[model samples]
Target: MTESKLRDIRWIFILLAAYFALQVGVRLATSHSLDLDEAEQVFRSQWLAAGYGPQPPFYNWLQYTVFQITGVSLAALSVVKNLLLFISYLLYGLTARLVLRDKALVAISTLGLLTIPQMVFEMQRDLTHTVAVFFSASIFFYGFIRSLKQPSLASYLIAGIGIGFGLLAKYNFAILPAAALIAALADARLRPRIFERRLALTAAVALIITLPHLFWLKDNLDFATARTLEKMTASDNASYPMQVAMGVSSLALAVISFAGLTVAVFATVFGKKLRSALAAQSEWTRLLERMMLVFLTGILLLIVFGGAAGIKDRWLVPMLFIVPLYFCLKIEAAGEETDKAFRRFMPIVTVIMIGVPAALYGSVATARFSGHYERLNRPYAGMLEILRKQAEPAAILAGDSLLAGNLRQDIPDIHVLSMDYPGFKPDISGRRPLLLVWLIPHKGENEALPPAMAQWLRANLGVSAPEALVIGVPYVYGRGDDSYRFGYAWVHPPS
Candidate 1:
């Protein structure tokens, strides 16, 4: 903590203030409803209780806390996300300082990395990525730094436990242990200190943290094989147009973010002379860079496959965890003349990256604010209103999975008796002869039930089915009467 080091931290704090000021303002102005994922967490958080339907409880629990502390509206809770996001940036900046040890360089790199939209958007939205990224990076960097002072049982415990919190946010964080192993091996100073005995202690801590989620995952999706299936199924999103966009947008983000961490990654690979000459004189410093690289490699794999397959830009956002480290590279990756050019334009690009996403987000918010539009959740808002008004407290109905989330929000007392798998099931009661509902389609457009279920439902109910079914993709009511999107909502009148 030299005077110079202290001054550098102050400057980073200043930059953080400026970045989030714009981000939070944008969040406030744009009024988008909870996203499908957000709604999933909220519904799970509110309805399902301790362990929400097939998902880990930690993220939902955090959302519940925000709901309790800040109330149900997502706006205030979004502020908490802002805080987590801030922590992530600080962690990245701190990593930058540790490597480059240059205040100006660290500031520029951090600014540049924040431009990756998913990172900023996750920070603004009330979801677990913020908490996961924040705790995971904070813990790893903290323990990694501490190991240098005097390797201790407690330091490893802290690092392992921090990753535990990260796992609670998302299962992919389990990759952290591998990063630690690689970093320790690569780091000359930290290597000898990290022998079998110390590594075992870290392993035990990580294992202890993992048990509960393991239990939760066991029933829903086999954590190991299920992730691959989930990844494969996600390929449905890779439309011709989507593949192109995913490739371009994801790569652009990765390159920009890597630019931020370039110095640290490069230096870790080759910065032996430079780091030893500077501060702390701990061999562990290089370990930190390689550790981050291992982390980066895992994320890069996820993105490459995820993007080609059409996974959401935002789903893999946690991997943006490496951006701040990448920022350092942008500064240090180049030699003198090239470095000067990067210095001149890097900050501007950083600002543009952050600003443009904020603007797009703001536009989304504005659109929601101006009109009663329906996305995944809101489109069902009107339908849920209709169902609530029409159905009995015990009405049994099947539903689209997307709409089930929203209907659950409105019809707390209503039960989803049954539904097609992989779609929304509104009925929680899980009993027989459920009063099925359907949207009457125009003639020749009735959706056929899948063969097996259609046979089963018909056999039990003892009738040829009517010309209709209650479920559709919760179509919305637009400005004028247009049957294109909204199907006429009708229940079967008594036979």
Candidate 2:
């Protein structure tokens, strides 16, 4: 590598460090509570199993490993996520260096990733799609670029590992390989590369890595896939036409939101000279750009057809990791003005990098005084204590996964069972009591136990009138006057 290239790589790391520091500072100042997604991974990591519930095992396995290494706490969880995100940023930069040789354009493409709200803002708080899958997707894309450049056994093997592990991280990873196949078929130059002996080895490696999880998935009755499908096909009161319209709009919004970030970066870095840059690229360079287009288009179509309700915008976050590079390659400046534009834009980029975290920190810090707490701001400590005192039960019966996950994380040695998904029927032998719990936000009025929890109590414990207790927990930063309410019911062992 040229000394200049080395210096650019160094700058990327420095910027990454600064970004991570900002994230950590915001987390500490706000005493950020773990979101359901974040808490769920930490909770799942507590147990070392090939499979858990209806989700892929790799994320949980990774979490469990981290917890074991660092010990479990909210801080430890944040650290793990930060490290994963940092690795993703590095992988993306390295891949950009490989594909786009222009140093200024590469730097802008690498740092510009944070401009996407989903990449930095949403990811800092989310554990699954944003953290785990983001890292895996980054690896997959890096390997993909290398393999496409040179279809050697080593490159193909790296790509295969990326595919296998990415799938293990999240099922959506299947989209990457599917996109590759479609892109190759469309590009005559790349089509023959897919039939190579080493590419076959790529498939074998992925299959081998994924084999154990496949067995576990089968043995568990493929709960993960079934649950995912159920979620997609969940009943909706809206007419079919309405559902289609809503799905189409949501899909469009997600794509546009992503594209807007790239467009902004391109405009700032290349300005009016962008068209010339595209016209000047070699055919090979342009082919790589089209591959990204093919990949995203394929993934977008699949998601739209799935018809899932309230499809999380975060699901599309991975598709954008390499998109900044994709756009830069297409619209990079042909003249030295590219350097001048980037220099002028540095201040603006810095402002964006700092302003986003400051805004998030401000919103969270003010929520306590406003008496309106988002889910992450709600206090969990007092509720955990109340559940312990009232039930002193052997296990925690959580009404939802988020509540259950936090309970498990905060209170050690307690087996948290979800009433919403009662897959665990602990043996009646020894007859241990269960602490049934749920969160009822501070909405001015006293909330009753959820109907589902009430039904579960009656059906399982034959105690329809379980004791109702409301415990008040102050918000993380709340004055004594501001707090959250928890409704709990203690159920005795079955008679």
Candidate 3:
């Protein structure tokens, strides 16, 4: 690498480190309450299993490991996510370096990820599994490209590790490797790697890593697939033809939503040059193009034949993350000067880098004035303080994962259980005092125990009826009048 190129790469690393550090700070400062994904992690991290719900166990395993060291603090959650994301960008930059000759294009390819709102905004906000899959996909791309270019045993092993972790991260990541395999097989030059004897090593490594989960999935098939199947065929109640149409349309919209911003940003910065680059195709560019084609085709097939009806843009991260790299590759092929384009792109990306974190902070900080109480704005700490003042309970039962998770974070030592996760049955039966906690929707009127919690209490604790304590705490940054209510009841152990 030239001195200038090396300097640019150093700066890229610095930018990633600084950005992720800021994200960690924002998360710590945001709120004590967990979002949906964060809550799920907190709940699941209580126990380590081969599989957790419909999603695979890789990300959970990482979170559990982090929690082991950090003891389930907000720092553990934020640092794990931001660190993984930082490494993902680094891997992506390395992959781009392999494919493109220009250093400027290399920097552009990596930094261009910022233009994707899902990565910059949503992933940082509250994403767990999706972020893991993105990291694994980046690993696979870098390793796969390196092996093909340099043909090293270590690179092949790295690719295998990526495949193993990708599957363990999310089932949806399976398509990426499948597409790459198809794309490689179609190319005469790249076909040898598929038939090469070393490929066995790759297969073996992936199988060994995934074998335990396969067994767990086999025993708990419904647990692994039921919710996903339900979401995929959510529109199955409609006519078959209508289902297909909706599936197709949903997939189309998902693609547009996922890739639209990156395309728009590139168009704005590079303008006619980007348009011209579209026609410039090289062997490596064709490889990526074909890989994308096969990936989309797989999704389309699932929609038409498999009755997939729901699709989300975030799910496309693994496959579509290559957009920036692909564009930069084509730009290089077209012999275009990116100095001017880079100048324009950097300012827009800089604004986004600053704006997203600020927005996350503002959303919570200004919730009192706006009367928009996001999950973070809820006074979980305040509620916990009041609950502790009344009685120190041996165990806490929450109606949902969100409540359970926040409670667990606040009181890490106490046994916190969520009604949502039935499989996790910690023995709260012999508790000195068991606390039943549920959210009270409205402010003024008295509310009874939620039906789910009521049934759980009766069946599990043999408490037919328990007095409900309605506790209202002011929002984190709210007027004294603006209070979030919680319904709690204490169940004393039977004599």
Candidate 4:
């Protein structure tokens, strides 16, 4: 690599580091409350298990490790997430460097990721599992490309490790390696690498990494897959034909939502050069194009036979993350001058990098004026303060995961349980004070404990009826009228 190109790559890494650091600061300043995904992490991180609900255990496992080091705080949560995101971007840059000849193309492809709203906005806002999948996907792609190009024991091992972790990241991530293998086999030159003895190393490493989880999954299939299966068949009540139609429409919309912005930004900046570059093709581009085709075909087959009616855009992230690189490859193939294009791209990328953090802050800071309350606007700290003063409970049981997670975050020492996840039951059976918590949605609403929470209490604690203690606390930034009402029952230990 040339000195200037190496310098450019170094700067890109520096910028990525700075950008993610900024995200951590923004999240800390945003609010004391946790978002849904953030809360789920907090709640689940209480235990390090082989499996956790519908999602895989990799991200949760990482979060748990971070908590051990940093303690369960907002900073720990934010840092873990942003760190994964930074690694993902870095891995993508390395992958781009392997495939594309020009440094400018590598930079362009990497920065182009910021244009995808799902990656930039949605992932940052509230996505834990999907973010892990994205990071794993990047590792897989980089390893896959490097192994194919260099054909080494180390590279193959890297590919194997990626495959193992990718599976642990999300169940949907299985398609990426499958699609990649199919794509590689189709290429005459790359086909030999698939049959090489080094491939066994990759397979063995992957199996070793994933075997423990496989055993856990075998025993608790329903616990692991129930929620994901329900989501996939959300439209099952519709007629067969209608189900197929909606599935197809949803697939289309997901693709558009995932790729539309990147396409638009490239087209707008690169103009006719990008349009003309579409006709250009190469070995690498063909491999990518074929991989995408196989991936989409796999999804289509699922829609037709697997009864997957609700397709989310975020689910498509790991599969189509190569779009930006593919575009840059075409631009390079067409011999288009990219220096000018890169100059134009940097400004847009800069604005987005700055704007997203600002928006995250603004969403919480201005919630009082807008009368719009996001999860961040919840006064979890104040509510927890009141609950702590009433009785120092040994355990806290909440109506839902959201409440359970926030409660756990504020009081890390207490055992927090949620009705939403019954699979994880901590022992609160002893003679110790227990706090039962639930939300009251609107003013003048009944302050009775939610039915689920009540049932859980009866089944676990043998308490048939528990009186509710209603407390009203203002939102983080709210008018006097805007108060969040919470009902809690402090069950003292029997003498």
Highest lDDT scorer: 4
lDDT of 2 at 378: 75
Model 4, position 218, has a per-residue lDDT of 97
Evaluate residue 454 in candidate 4 and report its C-alpha lDDT on the 0 to 100 scale: 74
Ranking by lDDT: 4, 3, 2, 1
1 against 3, candidate with superior TM-score: 3
Ranked by TM-score from best down, the candidates are: 4, 3, 2, 1
Weakest 10 consecutive residues of candidate 4 by summed lDDT: 1-10
lDDT of 3 by residue, 1-495 (tens): 356655657788789899999999988888878888888888788888988789999999999998998898888888899999999998898788777888788888999999898999899888899999999999888888887887778878888899999999989999999999999999999999888988787888889989989999999989898998898889948998999999889989998998899999999999999999999999889999999999999998998889998888888988999999999999998999988998998898899889999998998889768887888877777898888998898999988898898888888887889988888888766646888888886756558877888888778767775888788888877755888889989888877
Evaluate model 4: give its TM-score.
Answer: 0.97
Which 10-residue span in candidate 1 carries the lowest summed lDDT? 482-491
**Model 1 stretches astray by more than 4 angstroms:** 1-7, 14-29, 47-57, 68-71, 121-135, 149-155, 196-201, 218-224, 233-320, 323-354, 361-378, 386-398, 409-495
RMSD of 3: 1.6
lDDT per residue for candidate 1 within 1-495, as digits (tens), equals 467776757766776777666666665455434555554544554443433443356666666777666555545445656666676667666656666655556665566455555555444444455456555756665565565554688777767776666676665556665676677777565577566477577667767876776676666566334545465345455675566566556655654543434344334433453343334323333554666667656655655554444334444444445544443443354321234434554555565657665664644544333544435223445544554565544444444433343454555444543343323344333332244433333436545543443554565544555444343333333333322222322334334
TM-score pick, better of 2 and 4: 4
Clashes of each: 26, 0, 0, 0
Per-candidate TM-scores read 0.65, 0.87, 0.97, 0.97
